[model samples]
Target: MKTLIILLFFSIISIASAHAQSNTPAKAEQEIIKLSKTKWDWMADKNVDSLSTLFDEKAVFVHMGGSWGKEREIAVIKSGSIHYKKADIHSVSVNIIGNTAILLNNITLLAVVGGNEVSNPFIVTEVYVKQGKGWKMGSLSFTKINQPAQ
Candidate 1:
């Protein structure tokens, strides 16, 4: 009877541990999606303050036409050279690797650059690291989708 009780207790502990581990990735992914949407909203409105909160201290951004470190990216947002009129994220995929997450998504940005109108479609990949209390964007790389404009 003692052995049976001990076995059942161990089984329950194992089951609980497994369930907790399984939910962690899902929770992390959801947080990442939320972050992405927040970024899009901030960009659409040229909200520098909001965008600043999403980036890590050491984030790196490889934009379609250029690359920028965290400081420069923040400066760009502050400068407000290009206003994001609309941003559409078509699909998103998330992969958890240890304490890091990789997010892939297809995006469309409608904006004007130097008074020239443009609609940019891009394939974006971002790596996020779980910080002490939340996830911070570590790196972001994007490539322009090369199809003739309709």
Candidate 2:
């Protein structure tokens, strides 16, 4: 009877551990989604200081008109050259592979570039890498979608 009880207890612990492991990925996915939205908000607000911490030093950004590294991206944001007025996020999804997370956000972005207001639909891909206790954005690319925003 004691042996049976011990086995049962062990089985319960194993099941609990497995459940916890399963939830971990979901939690991470949610975290990545939240971070991605926050990034859009920061960009719209031109909060370069906050964005600087979230962006990795070796990060790259690809816009429709150009591609650049972290320093140039930060400079552009600071200068309000291409002001991110708003990001209407329609949908977001996240995929986790090892220590890297890929987030895709379908959005309608309103921007003021060259003193002209423009809106575009895009699929924004954001790549984040786990760095110690936090995650840093390593790459961000916007691919313009032919269809209109839903």
Candidate 3:
């Protein structure tokens, strides 16, 4: 009877452990998606303080016009060199691989650049890495899509 009880307890523990492990990726995905949306909001509002925390010091941002590091990206946003007026997200998906999370967002971005407003459809790839207790954006790239926004 003691052996049976021990086995039963071990079985319960194994099942619980498996369940928790399965949910971890889902939780991370949700977090990544939430952070990505918050980034868009911050960019539109020109909230560099908030963005500074979210972006890693060595982060890279690739825009249509040019690619730059975190400091340059923040400076441009603050100076309104490329104002991100709005981001109309069509679809978003996340994939977590080990300690890195990759997020792809299909969006139509309305922006003012060089005193002219333009709208463009792009598939934005955001890469995040686990840093201490939280995740920080390591890289962001915008790929202009030839197809229209759905």
Lowest summed lDDT over 10 consecutive residues: which window, candidate 3?
141-150
What would the per-residue lDDT of candidate 1 be over residues 87-125, giving only the tens digit for each residue? 788889899998899998787878766666788887788
lDDT of 3: 0.95
Query: What is the Cα-based lDDT of residue 33 in candidate 2?
Result: 92
Off by over 4 Å in 1: 148-150
Error of 1 at 30 (Å): 1.6
The per-model lDDT (C-alpha) reads 0.81, 0.95, 0.95
Candidate 3 off by > 4 Å: none
Q: In candidate 2, what are the lDDT values of residues 1-150, reduced to their tens digit?
A: 999999999999999999999999899999999999888899999999999999999999999999999999999999999999999999988999999999998999999998899999999999999989799999999999999866
Residue pairs with clashing backbones, model 1: none
Worst 10 residues of 1 by lDDT: 141-150
Clashes per candidate (backbone, < 3 Å): 0, 0, 0
Per-model TM-score versus the true fold:
0.89, 0.95, 0.97
**Over the stretch 20-79, how does candidate 3's per-residue lDDT look in tens digits?**
999999999999999999999999999999999999999999998889999999999999
Between candidates 1 and 2, which one is better according to lDDT? 2
Q: Is candidate 1 or candidate 2 better by TM-score?
A: 2
